[model samples]
Target: MTPEQILPSPQRRQTYWHTALALAVLAAVVWLARRHWPMVETGAVRLAVADQGWLLVAGVATVATWPCSAFAQQGAVPDRLPPGRLVAAQFAASAANHVLPAGLGAGVVTLRFLMRCGIPFAGAATAIAVKGTAGGIVRGALIAMLVAVCPGVLLVPSLDARYLVAVCVAAVGALALLAGPLSDRCRRALTALRAYLGAVHARPVRAAALWGGSLAFVALHCVALVAVTRAVDLPLPPARVALLHLAASTVAALLPTPGGLGSLDVALALALTAAGAPAVAAASAVLGYRLLTVWLPLIPGLVVLGVLVRRGSL
Candidate 1:
C-alpha cells in the first residue's frame, strides 16, 4: 500500500514489453524457419556435407561476408568506428535480419551502432541508404558482366509482354500516388541522401571502399554457392553456377522475405535447373548453400548478437 509500490517504474515496464516482444518474434522466426526446413532435402544435405573440403571452403566464404559488410558499412560513413566492434555489429545484424522482413532488423541494429559511434540520425540513415544503393548497383553490374561473358548460361523464362507492361504501369501509378503526398520527413531524407552521395563521391577512399566492398561481398556469396555446387557434384561449370546465383539472388531480393527464405530457395533451384543441372543435384546444391549461409551459423550469430547487446555495442 506504500506510494512507492503503487506503480511499476516506466523503465521496468519498457523492459518487460521489450522482452515480451523479443520472445514473440523469436518464436515466430523459429516456427517459420522450421516450416521451411523441410524444403531442403535432408538426404541431399547429407550428401553435400560428405565432401568436407568443399564444405569447409563454403563455410569460409560464408564467414567472409561479415567483414565485407563491415567494410561497406564503414565506407558509407566518414566517421571512424572501432574496427573490431564494427565487425561484431555486422555479425549480430545478420542474426537480427532473420527475425524481421525487408531487412528492418539489420537496419535497426546498424542504426543503433552508428548512433553509438557518434553519427547523427539523419547521417546514419543516409549512410545506410548509400550502402544499400552501392550494393544493388554492384550486384546488377556483376550480373550484367556475367551474362555478357557467358551468353546463354542464364535462361530466363519468357514472360508475356502484357504482364511486363502491366507491372510497369502499376509501378508508375504507385509512384504517382506517392509523389502527390510526399511527406516532409521523406523529402528531408531524400535531401540528406543526396548530400551524403556528394560527400561520398568527394572522398575517393570512401567511394572505393564502398564500391569495392560491395562488389567483394556479392562475389564472395556467389563463390560460396559455387563451392556448394561443387560439393553436391553438380555438373554445371563454376562460372555458370556463379552467374545463376547472382541472377537468382538479385531476383530474390525483391521478395522482402526475411533472409529471402522461400523465395530465394525456389529462385535458385529454378535457375540451376534452367542451367541444365539435374533436378536432384540442383536441390542438393541449394540445400547445401543455405545450410552454410543460414542454418549453420545461425546459433553462433545469435549468440554474438546477445553478447553485443549485453556489452552495449548494439
Candidate 2:
C-alpha cells in the first residue's frame, strides 16, 4: 500500500514531530554532558567514600524519592491506584524526565497513568497541577525556613532591577497575546482545577498526604545530598548543604533542561562554593549527587519504562 494509506495523516504528523523533538532533546543532553564531562570525571575519580554505611543510606534515600513522588501524585487525585504499579510508573517517569525538558516527560506519563485509571482529561490535568503547586509551596517554605535559620548563608548576587522588569514585561506581553486565543480553554481548566483543589482540601487525608508527600520528597533529596557530601568528606553542615541544594535546584528548574543536567551541576557547584565548600569538595559533591540520583538509576529506570510501555501501562 501507499505511504499515505499505510499511516493516517494526523497520527503520522504527530509521530514525526515527536521523533524530531526527541532527537533534538537528546542532542542537547549529549552536548551538555560532553561539555561538563571533565568536572564529572574529576569528581568521580577524586571521590572518597569515607563510610560505606552513609553511602548505603544515600542510595536508600534516592530510591525512596520514587515512592514519595507516587504518593504525592496519588494524593493529588481522589482515586486509589494499584500501589506497585503506581510506584513503577513513577520510577519510569524519572527516566522519561531525563529525555524531555522541564518535567514534561513525567507529566505526560502521569497524565497517561491517570487516564488509564479512569480520570477524565480535565481531572487528570488538575491533579497534576495540584501536585505541582503543593510542591512549589513546600519548596519555598523550606527555603524560607532555612534562610531564616541561617541568615546570609545563601548570598546570591543581585540582578539588575531593569533586567527583571524587562523579563516580566516580556512574559506578560506573551501571555497577553496568548490569552485571547486560549481564554475559553484556560477558563475551563481553571474552573476544573479550582473544583479539584477544593475537593482535595475537603478531604483531610488527601490534603495531608499531598503536603506530607511533597515535604518528604524534598527532604529525601536533601538527605541524599547530605549522604554524598559525607561520601566525599565535604566539610559543610547538613542544614546549610540542604539549603544550598534547595536554592540551586529552585534556580536550575527555570532552565528547562532535561533533569536539570548541565545547569544544575554548575549552579549547585557554584552554590556550594558560595556556601563555604571548597571548590573541589563542591564539585565532588555535585558529581556524587547526580551520580546517585540520575546516572545510577537511569538504566534500570529506562528498563522499567520499556516494560510499562510494552504492557500499555504508561
Q: Write the per-residue lDDT of candidate 1 for residues 1-314, one digit (tens) a residue.
A: 86448646885575456546555545655675576566445636556455889978998999999999999998899867899999999988888887665577889999999998889887898898889999999988888898898998866699999999999999999988888678676898778777888887788888888998898899999989998888878898888898889888888776566676666777898899888888778878888888888888778888998998898887
Q: How close to the true structure is residue 36 of candidate 2, measured as C-alpha lDDT? A: 70
Clashing pairs in 2: none
Regions more than 4 Å wrong, model 1: 1-49, 156-190
Best candidate per TM-score, number? Answer: 2
lDDT of 2 by residue, 234-254 (tens): 898899999999999998887
Question: How well does each candidate superpose onto the true structure, as a TM-score?
Answer: 0.80, 0.82
Backbone clashes, each candidate:
0, 0
> Highest lDDT among the candidates is held by which one?
2
Model 1 residue 270 distance off true place after TM-score fit, in angstroms: 2.0
